[model samples]
Target: MANQLSGLDQIFSALADPTRRAIVMRLCAGEASVGELADPFEMALPSFMKHIHVLETSGLVQSEKSGRVRTCRLSPDALVGAEDWFQQQRATWEARLDRFEAYVMKLKKEKEGAAAKRPSRASKRKGAK
Candidate 1:
């Protein structure tokens, strides 16, 4: 359990940065060399490498050095934990909201039913008159 929490912490912490998130998004399409990945941003290669390092440490990405080129690809399995967590959260919230809606609707119907059972002052006056 501790290991799972630690892994989630690392994944969320690594993804907290915009640059790192963008890098992950780009990698989602397919693998690319470090140069290609860094091309879109105006930062220096070294600066960009810091983001890649974070991603690697988080297990979100895997890179291989071949010749002079370093290529990176998404580690889809790493995202499974995060995805599962999100799906569970979504399901819980959906169930809660559905119950809330039902409660609200029940209250509304009860209110309407009570209102219908009561006679208006005008009707009372007409009957008395």
Candidate 2:
């Protein structure tokens, strides 16, 4: 469990950067060489490489070198942990909100019931008069 949490931490930390996120997004389509991946950015190769390094370290991406070219591809499985965590959180919150809504409805109905059991001011005035 600790290992899973650690991995999720790394994945979220890596994705915190817009550049790294963009790189992962691009790789979602297909694998591309390092040069091709860096083409859309204005940063230098070394700077872009840092982003790639973070993604690689997070296991969100994998790269291989052949000859002079280095190709990078997204590791879809790496995202599963984060996705599962998010889904769990969504379910929890939805359940909590549902309970809260039910509680509010219960209170509203109880208030109505209490009001219905009480005599109205107009009826009391009519009796007095």
* Residue 73 miss distance in model 2 (angstroms): 0.6
Give candidate 2 misplaced runs (Cα > 4 Å).
none
Model 2, position 21, has a per-residue lDDT of 91
Q: Residue-wise lDDT of candidate 2 within 2-102, one digit each (tens)?
A: 99999999999999999999999999999999999999999999999999999999999999999999999999999999999999999999999999999
Measured by TM-score, the strongest candidate is 1
The clash count of every prediction, one per candidate, is 0, 0
Model 1: per-residue lDDT, tens digit, 11-58? 999999998999999999999999999999999999999999999999
Per-prediction TM-score: 0.92, 0.90
* Candidate 1 off by > 4 Å: none
Question: What global local distance difference test value does model 2 have?
Answer: 0.97
Cα distance off (Å), candidate 1, residue 66: 0.9
